[model samples]
Target chain A: MLIVDRVSKKFNVNGKEKIAVDNVSVKIKKGETVCIVGPNGAGKTTTVKICSGFVSPDSGNVYYDSISLLNRKKYLEKISVLFEGIRSINWALTPLENMEYLSGLRGIKKNKKDIEKYIEMFELGDYKNQQCNSLSRGNQQKVAIACCLCLETDAVFMDEPTLGLDMEISHKIIKILKTYAQTNKKIFVITTHDSDFIEEIADKVLIIEKGKIMFEGSCEEFKAVQNTNTFKEAYLKYRGVL
Target chain B: MKRVITVFLNELKYSFIILNRYRINWMFGLSNLFLSVLFLNLGIKSFGNYVTENVLDLKLTQMIIGLFVFIVIAEGLNNIISKITQAKQSGVLEQIIVNPLGSKYIFVIKFFADFVIVFISIAIIIPLTMIITSKIISFNIYKLIILLIPLLFCTLGVGLILGGATLVFKKLQSATHLMQFLILTLMVIPSYPITPYSFLPITVESMAINKVFSSQISLSFGLLAFLYAHSFAYFILGLLVYSKFEDYAKTKGILGHY
Candidate 1:
């Protein structure tokens, strides 16, 4: 479980301070899948970064399973993050090589069989020997996901994981994530603007506007309160639109 | 400590993979070695005349050692500056920034990797030049070892500062040009034992060249200590700047912004 307590972040631009994330708070439970939806410049990414320990909050603390995240390696060990358009693996390395390298970093002991298992599971066996840059976008995304899952961390934070993926690949990724969450009891927190994806997989929805939480509830409850037929309607209504 | 070592090893492995993938870099290394050897031959041909004219007190062997130091420092600085710029352009910088590794670890690994590349070049070029110019050049193993300490540290320090600056400015081409200019100036202004003008030139030349091959190791040690202290200070300052601006860089959605 992750608890974010009144986290805020600000940036200075030309000697002026611009607040990105305001004093916002939220709680994510284990075995729960939460998706945060927001418009452009809505600070959803910043919130994800804060929760994942990539960006330090100016005013609040993040807790992982009741442990202070500040200066704590155990909390970090429990979390794995995938930022949008960010390739964490070395481009010169192959998919299998990247996986083995990251697994070594996480101190996971595995031999050739284990590595091949993950490669086959991700349907990346054909491209396992290909350099990362040579792979297609969807295949690269698969490799990135494989790297994260290889860590097998309890909590996963994905920022726009489906960006630029075609419908078929997108559905495949969603299914993989859902299966991972359901089978392993993992906590999945995704920040994306895609309402269809949110409706499909998000058990709970957290809506943010201009850095503050506008609403938080079960997707069903959110739909009921807004009297919407779709997640888009609920989102628009919560933002004070007709 | 084990974690630090782990980070170091990983970085080393990554560096080798990246460097080996680029066939051009190896070509550049070979060309650089050939050029250094050519210069050493030219210096040897003129050495006797220079000593006969009472222009130099040093042997051709010492001149060759000086040339080796120059080649290493030049190649090291150029490789580092260009690599940092390329990393930013190629999105490698973003990948590194998001990792859990600390900034100090990144800086140290980068510095050491560049140092190793330059060292390897020296190892290859120096021996080849000595073999070709066997009659003119002689090896002083102890002096060579002593010379390496300061030269490595000085080049490492300069490389770090330049690499960090390139991250902020993203004007590596101009920065590299300026670095070349500075190195040339440092080499030429030190006059060989000829005149008062030669005094400043000789002093600068001796300082630059002796740091890598002189028998007196203490001066080189002191210079290395100074370089390290300054390099570390700049490294910390650079990290602070990076942390301060990183969020802005991310929000602006410009990973390779100047």
Candidate 2:
């Protein structure tokens, strides 16, 4: 299990104080997928980054099992995070080369098979050997996501994992995550705007806006908000977009 | 050790790939360095040179050798900032730091990889300079290396200080240039027995190198001991400064901003 307790973060952008994440607490048990959805500037990415140990929060702790995840090495080893943008992949190298170096660091030996599977699944076979920077934006994201998948970790955190992916590859990823989560009994905490995909995969959902959690409940309960049958409708109704 | 080797070997491979990709860069840089050395050597002739009252009593051949030593030190120290800045801007530093092998080892591994490149280039540059000037100055390779070793640690220290500042500010080009120039001036200052410039970071070490180069001393144990001690001091200081700045950046939540 992974637990985020009362985490809050603030930043100063151009001399103005801005709250990125405010008093947000979340918990995920084994074999569970939790999805966070919100509008732009909702602090979804910041919260996930904090959980991944890349960004530190102002006040709170993230715990794995019953112990505080204080050791960065131990925490990073246990989790695989889908890094966002160029921060995830080294543009100086190829997708395969990155997998080799990065996976080697993670002590994940012989990850070529895993890398090849994702390359084939995402139709990245043509771009695998090319430098990551030269690839298109969508393709670079694929490399980042593929690198994340090379780890056989206990928990996975991804932000906008399906963004920029084609529907075919996106659907394939859902199936892959579903099987991996089930067989490994892993914890997954992801944030994305894909309502239908969330409806399909997420056991629980968080609706957030302006650094606050507007709603938190099971997927079914989230869909049942305002008597809406679809998650899109529930989200629209709850966010006051209707 | 195993993880370090893995990272080091991979870094080597990438260096090779980059070298092969831009073969002209190597050729251009070498030719440019050769020209600069040649020009300096030739330019000195127009001055109607006179002999020195210094300790080494350097003739033209000796002067060439001494300048070449300066070049070697400069070559080694010059790349650390640019290489680190490149990695930082490209997000390579951020991505690699997260590796399970830990950030500290990765930094050292990358340093060794770059140091290897500098070593190879210097190896090539010396022969090319000697051939270009047609100056035959004999010195012990082992002795030269012994003296040169301390400068590596000293320069690594300087590199770390600059890298630390880079970790926070991100736009330190002017500061980096200022430091490079300062290092060059300090490194090449005329090291006479009476010059009194020995307090510079590499001054004593460079004097040792010149002594070995002109065959004035036979690889003295006292000098080597001094170097070994100072090398420890500079390297440790560098590590501390880098770590201090890294800690500050982490606290400010600004490590990966650039």
Candidate 3:
């Protein structure tokens, strides 16, 4: 379990201090896929980074199974993160090479069989031998996700994992995440705007706006709060589109 | 130790991959090196008599050693800043920093990789250079290498400072370029028999290198002791300052804002 307690982050831009993530807190349990749904600039990524310890929160503590993340080594060992829009793998390295590099950093002696399995499962074919730059955008994403998932951590935090992926690949990823989270009892915390994907995968939903959590509950309660039957309608309500 | 080795070997693999992927870039870079060595060699030979004349208060061999030593030193220093900026813009820096092994390991390993990649050129450039200068470069090769240790450590120390700045400041290319120019200028400055300016970062190391090759008894143990002390000093100072800046960047939430 991962616990975020009163996390807040502010950024200074052109002499103005902008609050990026307000005082927000959440408890994530194993086997639960929590989706933070919001429109752009909703501070979803900032909150995730703070929780993941990539960005330090001003006045909060993140505890990994009751241990403060100030013990970064233990905390990081238990979690893996896939930040949005970053080439998590170097462009010069092939998919498997990137996986090897990341695993080396994570201090994992990755088994060859597990690597081959993930590559095949993610449908990364001969492109695994090619540099990430040569892979299509969708395949690049798959490789990045595959690298993170290969870590076999207790928790995973992903930002916009399916942003550029085709529906087919996106569904494949969703299936993998569901199976992994269910069977392994792994915790997943994701932020995305894909309403249908979230509807299918999210055990709990958080509607974030302007750095504040507007609503937080089970998916059914989120839809009930908006008085909507469809996840898209509830998400549209959160985005102020409906 | 095992983790460091894994990081180092894997990062080294990536450097080879980069060299192969960016053929045109390496082509131009290698050509530039060849041209510079050619011109420097020809220019020195053309001025062999005047240079032997000790017109600049130094021997011709001293100039060659100074230039080559500067080349190696600059490569180590510049590698840090250049890669930081490149990784920042490519968004890889964020991912790298978030890793459990920490950013320090990654950058240091990458630095070793790049240094080795650059040294592959040195293997060719050195002999070609010695041939150009007519091989009057007889001295303690072992001593010369050992003496150059302080220069390497000092360069790494200062490189970390500037590299830390690059992490936060983002557009530090002009600053780094200016730093390179200043470094080259300082290389020659220490050649002047000045006493008071001995305290500058690389000044002592440069003078120590000159001392090692001159084959003279001015062999002050004082300079050698200073070399050891200052090497550790600059390295430690650089590490401390780098960590401070890194922590500040993380707090300000700009660690990823390329």
**How do the predictions measure up, each by TM-score?**
0.80, 0.86, 0.92
Which model, 1 or 2, shows the larger TM-score? 2
lDDT of 1 by residue, B60-140 (tens): 455566667567667767766676666566544543454455433455566676667666767777677666666344446
Stronger candidate by TM-score (2 vs 3):
3
Each prediction's DockQ against the real complex:
0.24, 0.41, 0.59
Which runs in model 2 stand beyond 4 Å of their true positions? A14-16, A105-114, A164-185, B45-79, B137-139, B189-200, B216-219
Fraction of true contacts retained by every candidate, in order, equals 0.05, 0.26, 0.51
Q: By DockQ, is 1 or 2 better?
A: 2
Model 1 chain A, TM-score vs. native: 0.92
The interface root-mean-square deviation of each model, in the order shown, is 4.4, 2.7, 2.0
- Best-matching candidate per lDDT: 3
Model 3, residue pairs in steric clash? none
Query: Residue B85 deviation, candidate 1, in Å?
Result: 4.3
- Give lDDT tens digits, candidate 3, residues B1-258: 787787777777767777888878987877787678778767766776555455432455666667667777788888988887887777667667766777766776777778778778676666666676665666576776777777878887888888888877877766676776878766766533446666677877876676567543354667678777887798788888887878888898788777
Higher-DockQ candidate among 2 and 3?
A: 3
Error of 2 at A141 (Å): 1.9
lDDT of candidate 3? 0.78
